[model samples]
Target: MKYIVCFSGGHSSALCAIECVRKVGKENVVLLNHNISEEVEDKDIKRFKQEIADYLGIKITYANMEGWEYKTPLRVCKELGGFKFGNGPALCTYNLKTKPFYKWLRDNFPIEKGSIRDDVRIIYGFDKNEPSRIQRRIGVMINQGYKCEFPLAFWDRTITCTEEIGIARPNTYKLFKHANCKGCLKSGKQQWYLTYCLYPELWEEAKQVENEIGYSIIKGSFLEELEPKFARMKCKGIVPTEKIKPQTFWAMVRKEIPDKSENLPCECAL
Candidate 1:
């Protein structure tokens, strides 16, 4: 049996990798990463991933869409002339990350014919503080007949644990609450603004995508129109989210949250 941690080059996922490596032995643990090329090209996220791997001393592997000519979400949005957004995860979440990751899992770790053994365990990084998210994630994977677990939930480790481990967390965490794509479709005014100054090339692509779609990625203003409003503004460190009360198991089963595995255009695309 193999245990896979869906490493996202972020705090929670790194902690999960470390603890799981300690528990199951590094040979039994693999940090399975699925990435959007834009994340590496624009945000330079690969360096963070390398740091995590070196620090954790665990074997980390990646599953990426090498066959897809359009390697980035911005390109996909431009090709489609827009994307649908709602309460669900972003379109790229499936098209770029989860779908490929799932396909890799199925191909390499084929389900044995009529075998009942649970040969795989996938660990997601949702922290103990995010009980509702943890429950929702587990519920979705369970519904999909996956053997999933949340090590951070059990370990009760958060971002603080990353510091305790003597590794600096991903820079995206300092800029935003979550480590997502450089020009994520879900980004609001603030993130776009930061991208505009920090990564003009990616931001320009996003602007072009907005123009092609004839819709703002956010609610109202176009990226160009909104750029000046936040020009020269300092990056807001990890926006604080309002507390959603943790729910019971039954409540999670009953909750109508959208797909949890690809719930956000997050670092893990989960």
Candidate 2:
């Protein structure tokens, strides 16, 4: 059986790729990735992906969107017409990620007789805490005649390959929750605030995209409308680190800036 790992350049996915090699041997494992433009994706993420692929003795098979060789997220949103926020259908993700992935699949592994491909298993990096996501993914892949596995979901403990393999993780994990695009349009206010503070140029581009598209990346507030609030927090030295809860981070911010607003939501549109 060939184990094709959806090798997203995140810590969890990196571990999944390593564990897949350990289980089935490197010969039977394929590290499949979707390459985003460097302008959107961080350079450290690209480095980590290469390092992990090198460690596993396999080259990453990139599934790239044909026309979007170097399009940023904001550019994708602008050209795609509008950005969908918070659980709605996101055109950028579908066009940039999902469509290309399925195209690659069709080109490589054709479905025969409308049945699941028993000789191939697709691996995802969802952890044990995400039962609902796991089930949903299973449903989607099954419908498409693909079998799926979640190593992190079944493992007793987490497997982070960075320490054992001596490869430095992408720097995104140090500040952001996921190693997503630098200014991910699907992210919540917390991530946007962090982007505003760290990547002002990307933030400015996002604001411009919002203006061109005539809608906000966030549900109700344009980035321009939200910039002043983020500026205040930045002036007060408030920022987010990886995996910090929304309520807790906001409490710390309130201590410094004292906003009477209710706790902000940090759930991204994953």
Candidate 3:
């Protein structure tokens, strides 16, 4: 049986890949990933992916959309004329990631469209802390006719597999909790503000996209509307780190900018 690990460029996924290789050997393991544009994805994420591939003696298999190479999330929003579909991830995620992956599986395997395959087992990187997410993923994968494995969820201890293999974690983790696109459209004000501070170009593009699509990334507040506020906070040197709680972060922002009593909501951009 082949073990197909969804090798997202993060610590948990990295550990999952390593453990999969250890169990079934590299030949039977596939490190499948979807490529996002460098403008959004950190360059170090690619480096870390390559490094992990080398460590496992396997090549990284990319399943990016055929004509969407180097396309940012904003580009997808512009082309699709929507940011998301009814409480799901941003359209770019479905177009750039989910679509291509399933296409690759169907094209390469004997599995027919909407059919199940017993030969391949899908793997995810959910850790034990995420029981809800893990259960949800399992249900989804099983419904799609694939068995799933989440090694990190059952592992005895947390492992920074990259460090064990003498590689540094992607620098994006220092700035954000996950190594997702810098301006992920699914994110809310907190993430967008962080993007405004750390990646102004992408933030500018997001603002432009919002204007074009007539939809705000944060439902009520457009990125353009929040720009001046974000700029003020940036000027005041008040950017929240990844670990800061939303309540605490907003409280501090309000304390600094006393004129605004509005608290921004946030979701994990990943």
Candidate 4:
């Protein structure tokens, strides 16, 4: 039985790839990444794919979901009259990532006629910190007749701090965090602010998408309406001397309150 590590080129999947390689050896493991033209840049995507392959010294396969057109959440919102504030970006996750991922799995490893063994596990990199996301991914894999393992689920600051203070940092954490598309609709305002300052081209692309779709994704207001307010706003708040790490930010947030169990599976989990 082959052990496949589905690589989304995200932080979670990157960590999964590393753990899978260490446990099963590189020869028996495969890293799988999908390419969708519209959602992410071709150059950035290729770099991510190559980086993983080089880091693990393993052969990685690139899969293109046939006729997979890149459709942003904004487009879906325009067609469906927009989801509630938190729910708007969820549609993009289902359509762009999850659906294509499952489709690829079925095509390559068919279930009918019992072609593949049921025990072959799929490794996902959902961290222990994200209970809701971890549960959703596990539930989906179980329904698909595959066991799911999460190696980085319980990884904490000790491991991260040790790595950072040491000679090297994990490829998963460094590359994947910055690898998210510059204008990811799912990102919060802080992320969007950084994107606006750092990568204007991608920000413009997002704006164009919103305009073409005739819908706003920011919720409660459109970018066209918000731009003026943003322009007029003064930078009164102190800028941090060092940028806060994503993991640190999540850790701090998690400490402020108990993690809530999601009553319903995220629509993206589908």
**lDDT tens string, model 2, 38-133?**
878889999999999998899999888876656766787788788864566687888788888888887888897678888989999998899999
Clashing pairs in 1: none
The estimated TM-scores of all candidates read: 0.74, 0.90, 0.91, 0.67
Query: In candidate 4, what are the lDDT values of residues 1-270, reduced to their tens digit?
Result: 566887866645766777677677888787876655555544645566667678779877766544455544445444554433443436655665676777877877767652434646677766778799878877767777666777777533223222232323333233235445445666654465555555666667667767866666566555555443333221222221115665674454345322452222333335
lDDT of each: 0.66, 0.82, 0.81, 0.57
> Candidate 3 overall Cα lDDT vs. reference?
0.81
Model 4: colliding residue pairs: 128-153
How far residue 250's Cα lies from its native spot in candidate 2, in Å, is 1.6
Better of 1 and 2 by lDDT: 2
- Candidate RMSDs in Å, in order, are 10.9, 5.3, 4.9, 10.1
Deviating ranges (above 4 Å) for candidate 4: 36-48, 66-91, 113-117, 154-178, 233-270
**Higher-scoring candidate on lDDT, 3 or 4:** 3
Clashes of 1: 0
RMSD of 2: 5.3
